[model samples]
Target: MPKFSRRRFRQAKTAPHRGFPPAAARSAAAFAALTLSACAVGPDFVPPPAPASAGYGKIGASTESAAAAGGASQRFAHGRDVPGEWWKLFHSKQISSLVAEAVANHPDIGAAEAALRQARETIEANSATFLPQATLGDSYTRQQVTTAQFGSLASSSSSSSSSTSSSSSSASTFVYGLHNANVSVSFSPDVFGKSWRTLESDTAAAEQKRFQLEATYLALTANVVTAAITDASYASQIKVTRDLIAAYRTQLDLLEKRFELGAVSQADVLSERAQLAQAQATLPPLEKARAQNRNLLMAYLGRFPNADKGEAVDLSGLRLPGELPVSLPSTLVRQRPDILASENQLHQASAEIGVATANMLPQFTLSATGGAQATNFTSLFSPQTMVYTLAAEASAKAFDAGSLFHTREAKVAAFEQAEAQYRSTVISAFQNVADSLQAVKHDAGTLRAQVAAEKAAAESLEIARAQYRAGSTTYSIVLNAEQTLLNARLARVRAQAARFADTAALLQSLGGGWWNRIDETPASQAKPTDIIATSPIAAAIRAQAEDARDGR
Candidate 1:
């Protein structure tokens, strides 16, 4: 009520202190001590040990090579590294170019890269908690106040010098502008390392996304190769079917002429025509399969279905790798993207336990608000208008019906789950390698058998056709011979393609040689240009448009 009381409060605020001001001195010393003593509450992560097994499986050696480019006998080069561009080992320029195109264009790769970037950005945001949060602010206002609001205090000061008592007591208003500017700061000291633990968890999560991006790259490239192989196989089948149709048509024509001359019966001509029809019937499905493969390639290259269906990769163009690379099982744990991803997940889960543990401890915060205010703009920063406040708060979880306890237990359980999943991933990786190793061995034997069978069937067909022409055998024998040869030829083509595909599978199972890559950029730092772009087909489509514009 007295001006003396307001003066006393301001005088106490500005009074000199002997040293650092007892309260502030104590808080600063305590903050330094806590900073020196604090440690992260959660356990630090250690990577899981490599697997115990030395090798995937026995690499069965074959003595005989099959009769074609993809039918060569393969040997295992154990402990040798895989190449980064493994597809190029096939020595086909088309395959290499197409795989490069798919890797550059695939949507899955872009999505993975974006996810990795987001995870990294979240880490950066969380890191801000370790530093003080400061804000600069300024404000202006127009204000009006009534003298009656101050009551007796306003009347005593102004009554004697100003006017009559009734006028002082009656409501009178004053209007003025108020100006304010301030810098405010708040900081929570990491007394027990909650922020550090959270950061560790986030860092591990970002690595998880990194490996996920690697997995996407690995899958996209491998799929492109496998799809190319399948396309080539389908193309071969279509060609074989077309040839069979032509031969059957010619045989039918020969038999019809013989029938007209009475050299062959009407039944013979009808049977030949039926065989020709059957051969023609097999053509559509093969063509459909080849077309579907083209559509799949279009998808891999990030093109529409109507986009330039690229030329089908020829099965005979692919040269089967003779010496297959087989990495040790111990190394596979580190090499495979899926296995590494699971390991990161396990690491993140471990960090989470520390975060949950830290949550149970006390948290401390210090905040200061300093500012100046004045009724007029010119005096806004004057000494008499300055003001400030200091505050300290400490909080701990006291009782929450055992909720924090269960939350920690849940985190521990999650860590164990991740550990189990990591082990499962390792097991699956080893199994894939073993299966691929065996496939490469056995596919050769299958190829050799089909080649022999095809040769014998061709010889039998020629004998049957000749004997029937000499009238010593019937058309049914020749028909059986032709069918057998057709089956043999188709089977041989498949067997040939399998060797190339299985070799690829083995390489993929060994982690696709990503570690040997020259560009070591992780997914988190990748630019948008690194993730997505138009496929080679885009250029082709543009060319087609230009051709149409020119009336070509």
Candidate 2:
């Protein structure tokens, strides 16, 4: 057992009754001793290993291409002039507004914001473990006592009668109230840094939540952009199909006239009518799909998932950019919020291990409580009635049913899991960027080829019309050429929209903008986009979001 000294508690007893100087001096001395003697028992925290190089499946993004693009020196690269408002690159005001609206009012985003607030509160709660706790209380009681006739009878018959005549022994009742007032302060110094490690872990968890929120936001924005593009593309396809149907109807009229005149077979006129019906049928479904996509966009914006009456979602107002920005390396990985969040989680897990190890060591706590007491309420404030108790405690687990050992093992496993997840996140992020980059590139090429095919089909249709007028071809030839051209035009529109969607996806995966958008550090730097890493921008957003949740 550790020895105790009176001087440690009642320092003023040895000297004159002064003010709080002696108490303060004793407190300082005790703190110094605790600081000097304190040592944490658990394993020290060390960040889990992250892959030196993220292993990404190649999709055309290579070191040579990145270097040639002037982003070679960067660890995570990206193209420049990738405007912060990337949605604007598609040149659609409606799309931009929808994306903005979704970010502001999305239900999932709101839930994530609430979770982040809870995480902050959790950190604050955990911080109390390092400080002392005290509670104040009071109570009152009443009691009554009665004399029994049996006791008097046992004494003597005359005595019992006399006692009864004197006084019913008088039923006695008493009431008393007790009021207790005291202030207690306790401190279990982190000699071994257990508290510090715990704080670290919590900080990391908070960051993870932050990044998750950011990732969700980015994905939602991308969806809005993609949906808008698809809607417009469908509309364009409908127009092309309607035009083709009109052309086929004209051809059908001419073919029927020729068949009546014994110039063409009934089969030829029938083929033209069938082709016209097919083209006309195509318009309704395309329109329906466009409407459906618009509803989906509204849903993402936290609006009711139903079509609005005359709700005009203008896809035609959007413009596509001529070229996609291409930067590589230091910019791409650094700005990725999810990857940074993963890093924070790994750090948090490392801290948890430290906290678990600290459990194995001796724990020390210092406490002091003082209050005045008296039977009479009037004397409660008198210094003469004051009483105090100050003590220190130290304890160590001598035996347990393998609980501590298992806890340490669990934390270790958690640390490893965090590490693996971190690496996987990094790898996946890289793959997404690479795939999107290649998609946009190849889709553009496909669009050019389709354009050429459309031109050829249109020429063929014109030639077939001239040949029919010259009496060398039937209406079926003209209908076939028009149909081929219509298909090519529709295909081109889809490829164009797909290219835009791919570009938006790449931007979202690369964390929304150029390298300047993200902070590259072992300790994550927060951003407006940061859901997990403590970027200053994200912090403000989180504050605003939490304030909204609290109805502030």
Candidate 3:
């Protein structure tokens, strides 16, 4: 309980001028005393406990590299804290720079930052309610008054001219200016801590927005890094296609010369030419994919496709991060932005229950006005014309078909809903981490298989070419071998790229290390590229709460 008593309402005799009976006055005073002597009404929020589960449960809490996935091994360091700059672990300056550029320029980040700023400002505005509100006002008026109503019945019979003069003298109209000025102050005494609860709710709402901003940053930075990886993959695949095309052309040239020497049939030469054309055909689509991927990259950088500066990366440039972090399940619920945001919502809803309960309780207001009134502006503050008023009001509503009670019940339901949602968010976050972990483990297997197949196909292609050159096999066999190598080569590039993508996804699922960011309030300001400030730990729990009625 906190008290700042200006005065207490005293019960007195119900005189003719008294507004309420003595008994009612006493009841109000007692209510005020009891409420003022206690803390806020309704239950305070307690953060939900983290789950007791020790591991990511059958989802490969820890993993060792498969023997077949050799060279593609990623060591998952369980219970390790993810670094704030996780992308830097890839050791790609290209990726790091691109992420920085996108963060600085993205309109979505600016919008999210603005939302967070607005929420903070709202809390600032609500803080004004904690103190007395004072207003100063002045006004003037001009009007006319006459004394005709106070005149006696006229003496009619003796002299007409003298009677008319007497009447005119008794009733005269006068015009005058009127002026008034006053300063009035009013304050609500939060006997039940309605003010405190309201502030608590608002603060929670602000926190929710901050978390939303963090989520935005997490999504943005992760997507940028992933897109860059994909772009590199596309470029790598394109180069592989061109190399395959070149190989086919060389084989086709060899077959055409053999046909000219009558060492091979014309049909064999035609088959080799067809294979070369088919390999060439694969080039256009790969080029298209790479071009489109570059366009997507341009968009992420907040630029038009035509504005691209040919900022492209090579697959060889990105070093696969050797060490990867895997947070404990308990830590993830707190670190994940969505979960934290949901928790804030629960906090806000808990506060709302207090607000609603307070609304149904007695409310008290104190006000005072003191100033002066005169016939002119210069005389408005004169002592002789001074006047003042002091007032204390107490009110409580009763039995309006139970609207306030039902409203309070609604807030209870909302709190329950928020609690459930918080749990749901936690489940989804863990699922994400599990899914990424699986990708990290299995993508390697796919890559290893593709790499092996590509090697085998290349060997067979060489053997077929040698056999044809030695007149040991048909030219058609060489064409078939070339086709197999092309497919295997493309598959290997894809599988290799999948490894990078999976690593990025896993890092993202672990919450992108936003809690370790350098800037706590960077979203509102345009910081430098290297500031690492666009993200913060989700400190907000957004409340889509229904507004509770406050008894004023």
Clashes in each model (backbone N, CA, C under 3 Å)? Answer: 0, 24, 5
User: Which is the leading candidate under TM-score?
Assistant: 1
Residue pairs of candidate 1 with colliding backbone atoms: none
- Give the lDDT of residue 43 in candidate 3: 64
List, residue by residue over 150-208, the lDDT tens digit for candidate 3. 45556443358777777768578889988888999998877776765676687677667
Task: Summarize candidate 1's per-residue lDDT along 114-231 as a digit string, tens digits.
Answer: 9987876776677567568899889999988887776666556664645556655558889999899888999888766677567667767876787888888888888888888998
**TM-score quality measure for candidate 2:** 0.75
Residue pairs with colliding backbones in model 3 are 207-540, 208-540, 208-541, 208-542, 344-541
Q: Quote each prediction's TM-score.
A: 0.83, 0.75, 0.82
lDDT ranking from best candidate downward: 1, 3, 2
Q: Compared to the true structure, candidate 3 yields what TM-score? A: 0.82
* Candidate 3: residue 338 Cα off by (Å): 1.2
Task: Put the candidates in TM-score order, highest first.
Answer: 1, 3, 2
Ranking 1 against 3 by TM-score, winner: 1
